[model samples]
Target: MKKLWNIGIAAATVCLLSLLNACSLKEKNVAVLSLDKSFTTRSGFEGLLNGCYNDLYFLYGKEDFVAPTELGTDLWANVGTAGAGFTLYDHRLVTTDGNLKVIWGSAYSTINLCNTVLYYGKEVKGYTSQAELNAKLAEAYFLRAFSNFILVEEFGGVVLRTTSSTVEGVDNAPKRSSEKDFYDLIISDLKFAVQHLPVNQGLRGRVSKKAAYGLLAKVYLQRTRLGEAQEYARLALETAEELINHQTQYGATLYTSDNTRSGFGKLWAGENNKTNTEFLFIQAVEHANGYNPEFWNRGRTRQFFLPDLGGRGGEWGAREGSPLYGRSNSRRFKPSRYLLTQCFEPSATTADTRFAESFTYKFYANANKEITNALATTYKKDPSVVGYVIKGTSAKATASVNFYTQTIEEQTNMANDAGLAVFTPNWTISTTDKAKMPMMVSDPSDLFDPATNKYKDPAAFPDEVNLTNVHPALKKFSAPLYAQSNQYWMGDFSIIRLGDIYLVAAEAALLYNGDKSKAAGFINTIRKRAALVSREAEQVIAPTVVDIDFILKERARELAGEHMRWMDLKRTGKLTKAYLMQTNPISGELFDASRHTVRPIPQSFLDAISNADEFGTNGY
Candidate 1:
């Protein structure tokens, strides 16, 4: 009977049916199929738990979550172009934004699923083993807590739906709980998760004891109770220390920078796959098996960070096989000047492998490509008409002429030149010339000068570049092979990693005792992996002052584009001072701290509630 339930028919079937019906079926199914029907077995509960996990794909995997978390932070600058949820960065979001509605609804929907799993799993009889049952329940608790945490953080005092909203009418009109109550539930749920989750789940994506500890540490740090925050931080540090001390026990180790590859470099290279030890928790996105809808199961985060390269396809898109190269549709957001220059500090462009590994500033000539005289006129007339680079071997190449600058006469002269090979009328290029020409280069200064061990012309690089088209393309989320029609990238997105745990512990220690040395030690561990020299030998090492600003900068260098900046700034109350006030040539804004800390509860949500007046908007 347990084996029968392991196939996930009980949960998957019900979930599919409910999805079709556009409403939850948990209560109805519970009544229709009792515990005796093998629907309440340990395996049955596991299926329901899987459903809760699946819901995350819908919640965090969307643009809404990414927009609120990434854009308008210290790291990213909105390019003032229309993309999914652009208003988030501009701080022009309203109560009726589509993405907000999805975020709000999807979070609660996932929470409901988690509640259902927890509610009925206790009543199940035939557990194959008590350990299995406990593990499944532990996962449910973690998912429930995580969903609620996202809710409370985003909306402040949101409705706390603990039990399954299976009884639809009963839950339909629930009131918002106090912020303290929300944190209490999150803490309790995480404590339960830590108690029952195994140290090793045999899969990197699954929740583990270490992951629970890491999340708990973050939760406590976020909560307003300073004493409790310090206490939990200590607990989190102990667990992190233990994990670091006994790496083999948990199959975890930091990526070390070698001559050829940096630890941060290895991560985007798909080296952080399912078995990679550094990952604590990941949203597992596999290539669709042709049966499931790819949209529901695949990850497209890579699309959001991409630069608008629609016209410059062959000339400037991702490299053939490099991890930093990928096809992207909407180049929604670009790296903020602050993040590019300050976070990695005096020499990010050269010293920090993380900076180099995370961004693509150059695109090589793909093939013997050219634009014709006729095409050049058209391209000149339309600024959007851009060329692309074909994947090819090219070395010692002169930088390609800026298409934006070329006159039609110059293009015609090149086209008529008998000595030149005309690949197309707008431009002429020999196969020989292709090997000697760069397709596109955004920032020529990004090239490192080994003699000085720093990027050339570091001071000359302008803080304000053309934000609309030219900027560093984020390579961290690149998924070349998994791209869908060269529009979106499909890759597994990591939610937590051991590197982050170290930072968490560092912050916790700093807050707990104000001991800079202790905090610096943890931060240095991350710095060492980045190939930074020891602090004693180098003046530009991890901050001696272990303050929030220092820690925030370090986080930016290490964790940018991982959807953490907004939360980090908000949690530390630095959103306005660090991000809003900082002027940039692109999409900088004057954020209203009082009203912008939390987003407005979607207008649709308020209108749907019975007591709509009581459920007032947040910080509107």
Candidate 2:
């Protein structure tokens, strides 16, 4: 439940060493107290695995230094400002420094744990079924591959240590492995995982054959083994199709609507794995940890989402257009106009529904408590808006009711702008001003329902409850009623989902196999569901001519801030070009050629390695 950030490798090592001391039986058994048999047994192994999940989970949190780096940077065009904050990050540019090391250290720590388990899980006596052990090893392999995938994507080449950290002369320091070699290891591990992991796991949230296949396909795609990539991608897609097409309710058990948002983006939200059909692997979370997310690192949310929904004054600036709007206190990350333009039009006329209801807008009601759709009163909408808004412990907004009123003719007379303005404001008063308008009356209770529930009152239904339109206070993460109680908020972050596979397969079918119509068919299927209107009303689907370039852009529109956009560009060799087009409104800047593409390797690594000069640093 508690988030596990990166492992303190040095501290863990010291503790383990002390625990192994023979004299730790009685007198001064401090080491034994720290490192008990729990670290050595099957249950202990499971605990370590859980601990590994905790550490890895941090990679998916809000903190850029530790969370899913690719999701924020490499996966998508930059969401926030550049230099220290936004534009600088838009291009493939990032300087690997202090906190970036957390990713490296955490990754290595997990590798060591998995290696230790693979080495020792077999030695433990009195174990469960052999199937369980194999499954555990398979899981270990899958995790190691997953972790390595992260490292390879970020740091390029890394020292691949399969065993526990060694202190002996020969193992005191290890040289970095070549990227090819590193990826080879990943491939081997994934292949093993694919072979050993069961197609179905009895327990929910467990990795299955489909998960392995999906990962294997991903690995192949990254390696640029086109044939292998296509083969595995098809295999994964086929398996996924079976699960999706099946009438059985097995999937709903895995992913339920209670906690997750209703879109492809939910996969990266990191919580609520009830929909087993899509989520292959995720680092689950139950309790909140301030230090583990962007909220603690700075004011940013887990990732950017539509303009802030929670009444402003929390992290990520006052909810963009809400009554709580303001200049953010710690402007670490910021959404830009260029990025906003990238998200499909939020209006009903747009073909992309994700741009509409899928996101919460920043505009909130003015004195009349009515919402204005004007950009001035709206938050900066962007691709990053698709990212999760991890509500922090210090959030100040409290749950309250919004009210609306209308006569029968008034309800039908939707064109009465002034009448609508009474319930929904025509303009949003910026949060910069703390003054509250008297006309902005709050509904007394948190009960405004359309159904036959006790909260249902047609007179004060959605209209008065602030439900009729997108407002700045409508942030993705529900604000905690009490800031302190936020520590207990349960939200999982996602890394992948079923929708991506559909998109990927659709793209692959057209690009690699020359099956344009089939690709368009698959993509159209997804688009239709999202409320996206077809370019031609008579033909409601993406064309089958299969424009790879167009589909790439479409993917950005559909999947943007979920952390896949940047990578898509990178693989297509458009990282630099795509980002250069993004302009920062605050500074009137474009992506700098030198600083936009590559991140500098951490200085600490340079300091640790004697021949570090051999490894060139990224231009940034």
Best by lDDT: 1
Q: Candidate 1: lDDT of 415?
A: 29
RMSD of each: 9.4, 12.4
Per-residue CA lDDT of candidate 1, range 1-620, in tens? 22222343345444322211233232355542453345476566566666666556665445667777776566665544443233343445678877677777667766766777777876877777877788878987898888888888777887888765452423435587888899889989988898899887753357888778767867777773334656666665666676667666756677776666666677666435535567767776553331222343345555566654445443332233222234444456666556766675435235557777776544433334544434434323232223322333332212132111211112222222211211211112243433333333333223322243222334544442221344566666553434333333445667878888788778877877777888888888787677534321242355567797889888888898887777787777676744454523232344556667777788876765566677778756
- Candidate 2 lDDT by residue in tens digits, 104-169: 666666676677667666565446687767777888798888878777766666567676431211
Error of 2 at 533 (Å): 12
Candidate lDDT (C-alpha), each: 0.58, 0.44
Model 1 ranges off by over 4 Å: 1-38, 81-91, 167-169, 202-204, 224-229, 288-297, 312-324, 345-349, 370-439, 444-467, 479-485, 488-490, 532-543, 577-579, 583-588
Model 1 per-residue lDDT at 381: 20
For candidate 2, what is the lDDT? 0.44
